[model samples]
Target: MIIINVLDNFQAALEAPRVLSLNSSKYFSGPYGEDIVFIANDWHTALLPCYLKSIYKSRGIYKNAKVAFCIHNIAYQGRHAFADFDLLNLPDEFRSSFDFIDGYTKPVKGRKINWMKAGILESDRVFTVSPHYAEELVSGEDRGVELDNIIRSTGITGIVNGMDNREWSPQTDRYIDVHYDATTVTEAKSLLKEALQAEVGLPVDRSIPLIGFIGRLEEQKGSDILVEAIVKFIDEDVQIIVLGTGKKIMEKQIEELEVTYPGKAIGVAKFNGPLAHKIIAGADFIVIPSRFEPCGLVQLHAMPYGTVPIVSSTGGLVDTVKEGYTGFHAGAFNVECETVDPDDVDKLATTVKRAIKTYGTQAMKEIIQNCMAQDFSWKGPAKLWEKALLSLEVAGNEPGIDGEEIAPLAKENVATP
Candidate 1:
């Protein structure tokens, strides 16, 4: 039903540019359906490329349009029973596009319809979030989630995602109580730290190293290992703050931290956008121990605020962080294991202790300046996206349809359908 709804709305969007205005003597003055390039992101919209190829293009409408499929995370590919293929309402000839036979030892055996596979097969271009993640997906079955071969054959590109510097910037963020750039970071962060400590019910001390963990508390985000690492530091002077909600077990564990080690730890198991800004602004270090990250945004958010990240070296975490310079590597997690490794917990705790040792040193100040100076804005990534999209133009066709110069469409022109 979602596929059908998306297809119907897509067809409507295709016809929108041709709609005649009843008040004026002109139609919508923009590129028509044939000039558009659709981008389908992840599994929810993965079927768009397949439908465009097998339905719209087959009917001679949107003949020149192309689809680029973006894989944010390959783990959650839309898989359903082969019998449910009929719900798609596609022709019998396209059935082969959705067919899959699982050969792995995992459960859910026999044939299934994999939407992400079809998207990769049908789309003109395929890409993931970060270059490292792109390589990880194609490296082996461990990171690929059973789609590595298809990803390798399709040839994935990686464009690291960008952060909204305006919103996340320390100098201009409206959410934060105080503002600071590299020059004033020390004094400003001290003030913000005191304020945040008071707000979260922790002891208001600016001298102690205040560490933060902000993300979904799940296995992927390494919440279990974070808890274990906190246990190792229960007797230490460092203070830790965690912001996010996930599995009830993880939430309970986080809440337990405050009770187990009063004045040293606090966890808020709910989403609070304003507090998030305050935490990033106030904390000395941000922890992102993701087991497998696909171009994490939290680390990017931390960098501009001079909050050094202590992250697991996997996927985009490896791409963005420079050890001992911008942040510390908490060591990589075992990708093949179903549960957290004790060694990973020890590594994270050791790294946190190392960071605490470096807290007020001259070297730590230099690291803060380096972190603040690093740029993760969208300007560079946007150009790469434009170049990638332009390369998808059909060989024989001119850049524009019917001699009209093909101006880049604004965000409003891109249809979510």
Candidate 2:
């Protein structure tokens, strides 16, 4: 076993993995026998062909190597022009699967191939971060982009991600001004909320239900929806504190709201980890109204803080947050029936209003306790991953070098390159 590190000073190319794929993978891939090559997310998966060709050229077709692809998000697929294929050093056979084609046309209009698609097809085993997200990627209306048919033909396994409890615990987190546990959460919340309000220049009133938004200011994170519903949120006497940055338009809108409704809405358009931790601790409820969340760690981070999450029922958020139990689920999708529509402002307003009304009540206290009580440690999820990997290893080595059982999967969607 050998590990080689390739370092490039070009930052721009690194951001666009497609540009760096060939060079990076050429350095990373090597000839090996009975080995597993695990690729992570779209960034590294863009180099699938490069890695495969390198390994196969040196080790031959029956080298007994299996590739595992782990998908964090189906969005943000690394797409590049067909011209760039020349640089990949791959055999002429990989063109069709790696080249993008428009699925809209009957004849299939050729566009740019999505690198994520290539990785999924090339992978011996596909794993997503959460079970619900895995199902959503394959079966639902909001399935993975241009790869659902292939995913259904093949199969994907989902494992719910576990949170790092030691780093995220409110009781022990050094980021927060106050240390708190489930028993001390209420009093700590009150003090921190007041302090946070003063710091952000919002009203330091303990009665107002302060909801926190700590993520990217993008459509997926529902930043636009939150901005749109600001008047309504203000109407309900709910104060909002947002900490993160993204789209300029959304940031402008948030900034405008802060100006429009002084002491009600505050947007800090920057990435500050300490502030994020403080927001999770101080805010009564953390809001995660993402359009499609694969496995959101924000809600997990919030749970242990006794900070209830108001989430859109999708992906890992749906799996983690129990409706009306530990947290509130805004009806972005019907969890039971698997239907989706644009989130309604009125519905979100109602949900926030309900949370505001229930704030500080015995019921809310119980819910907070439940949120804190729930376990999301890595122990179980790690074991599940280990078992899956072991099974794949066993399956791959069954027929020795003649490995026709697993070899058939390689021919899945590849056109004659």
Task: Name the top lDDT candidate.
Answer: 1
Q: Model 2: clashing residue pairs?
A: 92-417, 93-417, 100-112, 100-113
* Candidate 2 to native Cα RMSD, angstroms: 10.2
Q: Against the hidden reference, what TM-scores do the models get?
A: 0.88, 0.80
**Candidate 1: deviation at residue 179, Å?**
1.1
Please provide, for model 2 over 1-75, each residue's C-alpha lDDT reduced to its tens digit, 9 standing for 90 to 100.
Answer: 111332222222223332333323332433333344444555454565346545443567424445667888876
lDDT of 1 by residue, 139-253 (tens): 8888998899998898999999876676678898877778888889999999999999999999988999999988887888888888988888757789999888888999998
Model 1 lDDT at residue 412: 25
Candidate 2 local Cα displacement, residue 228, angstroms: 0.8
**TM-score winner:** 1
Off by over 4 Å in 2: 1-34, 57-62, 103-109, 140-142, 333-343, 394-417
lDDT of model 2, residue 147: 69
Cα deviation at 166, candidate 2, in Å, is 1.8
